[model samples]
Target: MARIQTEHGGRNVQVDEYKGKKIEVATGYDARSDRWPVHVYIDGQKVSGQASADNMSEAFDYGFALAQREIEQQ
Candidate 1:
């Protein structure tokens, strides 16, 4: 898998390509909520249903899986 790091909305984003599709995972920590927010984008389009996790790694996992599922559905 090819991976790259970029920034989106002032947050660091990790991007991977799968099956010729670009999957971007952006994670951020919300101090007030005490949770990590994860956003997944496929081919530059944001996927629905945002997810949150207790840590960064888990957040990324959720985002990656969400992106993969989106690509599979398409």
Candidate 2:
């Protein structure tokens, strides 16, 4: 449970751990509504994709699965 400072400033972003790897989750915002519109960041990359459900937990699962698949493939 730690945050790595990004160029985006000093926001305390959470980094999750999976299989000893670090994963980060971020949300997309609806500028007009100021609401997070279904998005997740994995290791600072947009990996949950655009068509994913608007759920944080689901996003986390997707991130973990994607990372695991890539690791196994390599």
Candidate 3:
């Protein structure tokens, strides 16, 4: 597992191998409302969107799934 720090978002982001590709999961608070959002990036492309949630774990799960599904289609 690896971690990345993004100035805009993704608090303590985690990187891992998934389905023969490198998947990244990140969490950070939105500029407004202080809501934590999870974002997923694959191969430098943002496959998943920002998902706001109270817990980082749930958000990451959703974001990761979203990214994987999108990648499968392409």
lDDT string for model 2 (1-54, tens) is 344423232222335665565666444434565444333454556653453434
lDDT of 1 by residue, 1-74 (tens): 66677764447689999999988999877888999899888889989886899987788888888888788888
TM-scores across all candidates? Answer: 0.86, 0.42, 0.67
Return the candidate ranking by TM-score, descending.
1, 3, 2
Candidate 1: where is the Cα deviation over 4 Å? 7-10
Deviation from truth (RMSD, Å), model 2 = 5.4
Model 3, residue pairs in steric clash: 11-27
Question: What is the Å distance of residue 69 in model 3 from its true position?
Answer: 0.7
By lDDT, is 2 or 3 better?
A: 3
Q: State which candidate has the highest TM-score.
A: 1
Top of the candidates by lDDT:
1
Worst 10 residues of 2 by lDDT: 5-14
| CA lDDT, every model vs. true structure | 0.83, 0.47, 0.67
